[model samples]
Target: MCNIVGIYHTLPCCSSLTVSLRCSLLLSLLKVANYSSLDACLNLRWPSAESEILPRHVPKGYFVMQVLRRCPSNTSPLTLQHLKSVWKDVAGDLNVDESLLTDEDFLCCCGSSSPSVNAILGGVVSQEIVRAITGKGAPHGNWYYFNGLQCTTTVEWLPNSAISS
Candidate 1:
């Protein structure tokens, strides 16, 4: 398995350029972690996990998704199509099977390419209103599916007594 902490240390903060870089980085990590026999397309030197800053109570997969989903004010939101295009390019560059990068492997709930008109506003307020009205609506934050599994954005902290039980 690939060391996510090591990969995290090597990544730069989110910006337009950095977002693209991070995309490449994430794909590389996925390639390494998922495929053993395939040679990497990019000759990236992964860093050691010596100076890692861990996120609060998040798994490596969640942390990586957070990093991938970050869209700074200066950058446009990343679309699944763009990600797939990048994957294809990377596969071509690396001489690997493009089929390996499947939609089921990575799912991102980003805005659609075509614009649409909706009655309800979208944000925290919208989500709260929907929840209060219908008891169920959209999820709290951006949705991501990694390794064919979905993850919750929020984490609950159990009391120390509960943990001890």
Candidate 2:
């Protein structure tokens, strides 16, 4: 259960230059302006290969996390309009333009609650995203690490609001 802080502590300052560089670049891309946000963002479950400290595909998991956090509720299915609005909020929070994020970008469905083709986030299927976000196959927060270990990561639902930094 190695968190970002834990992993950072495991390595000498000079020994983790690559991790440092990746962190800086990812932090900028994700528009994390503070230390706390960086911690939360890095702690989220991401796709990774063996023993990788960071997620293999960060942006995909990150976008899914943001969407889930912004959702009004977890039980009720999310609507496209609501999803669009949530994306707008996400853009605002990241200080990016609304145009940069659209329902089409994520392939979210419009005017249909029934799940099907084109109903989920574009390339990333809704079920797969949910599974990863809930830590089924991916690493859970503090429950497992990206160090290629066999640990039981818990499957927890997303909170109603975004993770406070």
Candidate 3:
């Protein structure tokens, strides 16, 4: 919300600015960045009045944060390592490596005999790209899945990593 931010910055004491004004300002900022609407960004809800402002505090070395901090950089080796860790968590320790895997690699454990898996996976990836570029819906950061049985598709998000040269 650039307009809101601008308005806030210019007129910090304007008490009459409504939520709609804030939203409008935010939308303007997104527009300048080539985004169309608020839905293009992740939806985050504010805490309700009844909710505690400070919940149970984390003691700094939380496991989730540790994993996040170790997220692979953009280098192929680092990406592969990240994928290995993800696969270990999801598929339980498959012997995956960087060998032929690119950052864009899409692997399906479905048997080689099943060409359907390839088609489905490709379609799912394409759909995700379309959604991301068109800003039609949420951005699919990295992973995607297609279930031929259910004819359903899902997208997964991955944290951004800083690759050292």
Q: Which candidate wins on TM-score?
A: 2
lDDT of 1 by residue, 6-89 (tens): 323545454667667666767664421122121221121122132122223223333233334443435655666665666665
lDDT of 3 by residue, 1-165 (tens): 322344224423334466567566655644222222333212211232322211122111122223333455454343445654654443222112223232333222122336777777777678877875665554443434454444566443322212221
Question: Better model by lDDT, 1 or 2?
Answer: 2
Deviation (Å) of 9 in candidate 3: 26
List the candidates' TM-scores in order.
0.26, 0.31, 0.29
lDDT value, residue 24 of candidate 3: 64
RMSD of each: 21.5, 16.3, 15.0
Give the residue spans of candidate 1 off by over 4 A. Answer: 1-74, 108-165
Question: What is the alpha-carbon lDDT of model 2 when measured against the actual structure?
Answer: 0.42
Q: What TM-score number comes out for model 2?
A: 0.31
lDDT of each model, Cα atoms only? 0.38, 0.42, 0.38
Per residue, candidate 2 scores C-alpha lDDT tens digits across 131-159 of: 65553343223211111122212322221
| Candidates ranked, most accurate by TM-score first | 2, 3, 1
In model 1, the number of clashes is 0
